[model samples]
Target: MVFWITLDPLSDLSRPPGDLSSGDLLNQVLYVALYCLTMAKLIDLGWRGARPLLHPAYLLLLAWFAVSAVLGVNPGTSVRRLVLCAMVMSIVGVLPILPRTQRDLELWLGTAAMIVVVLCYLAVLLVPALSVHQADAPREAGLAGDWRGIYDHKSTAGPMMIVFLFIGAFLAGQGRHLFGGVLFVLSLVFLLFTGTKQPTALMPVILLVSRLALRTRSRLLFLALCLGALALYNLMTVGSAVIPSVSDIVAKLISDPTFTNRTGIWNFAIDRFLERPLTGYGFMGFWSTDAVLQSDPLGQLAWTAEATDSHNSYLDLALTTGFPGLCLALWVVVLMPLLDFMRARLDPTKRGLALLFFRIWLFCIFVAALETVFFLRDSAVWVSFLIAIFGLRYLACYPVRP
Candidate 1:
């Protein structure tokens, strides 16, 4: 778990360029070291409580990484990501082992909630305060809007918090008594302040779905009314002269067109794929030297300077690691959660929690359609979520409450 917490330093690019003459190699070494340490600790622990690590998803992820390494254009880069994945897999592996009781679950959740509180504050208030730019198209996004965050980008952090929001909302719903309400409220506020589109859209949808899922008779009707009211609010605000900011943002959304030109990038990447159609330009290698090989006919794209990721995880996987890596990555994400769905339903009480977590995870996947390539990055947080689902699955199989 400690490895999981700090494994990110391996991927951290914020280190001063002069401090580390060579950035990439240092990051690679750090990742490898972290992986070794975590594996050694897990082995020393006798694998007594290490169940999740042995799961199908964990094994598949490792295998995918191995394949990626063998096929990777930059074996070193692939290796670093592989090592980071191993650390995260270890954390998930340890989840079922460490917190075996409700008290433990509550304690862990409380600690996580506290961390979110601090992180959210940093993200919202402190980061915004540190902002130096104000223009819509400034030289840099500034602290106020890094687009990416302390980790990778808002794309990652935003979806990550949505997962936490689901967890908090679930616990709060499960009768956490007094503290639950506070957690739920904080989760909502944090979700809003994050300002990512998916959370903004899905939060209300989750609340509505949760109310229905809980079987609160008539509550569904109330939700419908509330939704109507929300529609009315949007309708009234859409053109009202009183709210210029809202109008400006809406106009921007409308005018920007086709999701900020994601279609163009997708088309360009696909055409490049058609060129090689088989191996492509070696994993993560194209964007560096051979990006021109990509098909960006529109010339309205950024294939060089700001073209680090493809936004779509599947597309990025295909482009970087080819079809084989793409298949494995998708399988690990989709199959694991779907498998847990049954275990979740086995116990009606925990079904909602299971569903909420699943929804949040899927929401990330959905948002990935237009944002970051999460699997390529240090996905410790998402991996934690997968571990949590595994834990709940075990709880379903071996009942404790009854």
Candidate 2:
């Protein structure tokens, strides 16, 4: 949690010649702790008890990632990424084993989230130089050049606050009314100051839909809604290219037709992906590579040299691991767990857990369209999604009746 909040803070802290970033170092330590705990649990449970704890689809997904990394363009970097991937999955795998009850899990997570939120507030109040974006710094649309509130960029802060908003909602539902309400309001204020347009606009609608989904308690309904939304998004994306009116209207609405110049980045990424359709350039390969920089796909665009990611998670994954990796990811990271969540009986006692996971999954799906989040190393969003996926699986298999 501390690591999540302090994402690579620019401190005068000294380190060895070849040390990892503070965030990565902390993540590795957490991974080691989780590994030890998981191994201990496995030993105590024995093979029969542990067998059910393993999710076959997740294991298969891990295997595919390993294979892709081994065969990837940058073998050294891919191998390192593969290690991080395994560590992340291991952390998620042990979640069910670590928590004694749903309440216990909720309490632990809620408390931790609250602590992070409080720390963010303190950083913003005490150290504005480090926490807020500078006037001359790049600003996103709708921010009016205000504070980012404890994150390096407005982009990062916006998404983090969004996560905290839902976490606050969950805490409130769990009867931590005052604490949760305060956190939610503070998160909203911070989000507003960051000036993030999409997430800020979408929050209310997402919350409303989540409430409806929980009330319906029908997995098919949720799935149908998701499919419909995805279809609509695709249509808009396609229409932007084929229909001038659609493009004009979107441009008028957002005040930037190219989605703040993301289209150029996406186009470059697409071309790069086509070059290596079967196996991509490798994990974190394309953006920083000399070949990509030399090609200069963006031409005279302002952000050409500054862009780090494709901005779309799907595109990023395709660029990193190609079609095979993308397909495996869709199946294991998304489809399988979605199917499981839908099929699992949502008893009264499990409804809260079900709804929490459902909300997180839905949020992840929506956010992926605009952000490069899937399988990102040391990312809060990715970690949150893994928790949701594994937590739902645990609840489904165990079927705790309160």
The TM-scores of all predictions, comma-separated, are: 0.70, 0.85
lDDT, candidate 2, equals 0.68
lDDT of 1: 0.53
Query: Per-residue lDDT tens digits of candidate 2, residues 78-111?
Result: 6676777677666566665566676777777777
Worst 10 residues of 1 by lDDT: 13-22
RMSD to the native, candidate 1?
8.2
For candidate 1, the per-residue lDDT at 390 reads 61
Question: Local distance difference test, per candidate?
Answer: 0.53, 0.68
Question: Candidate 2, TM-score vs. the true structure?
Answer: 0.85
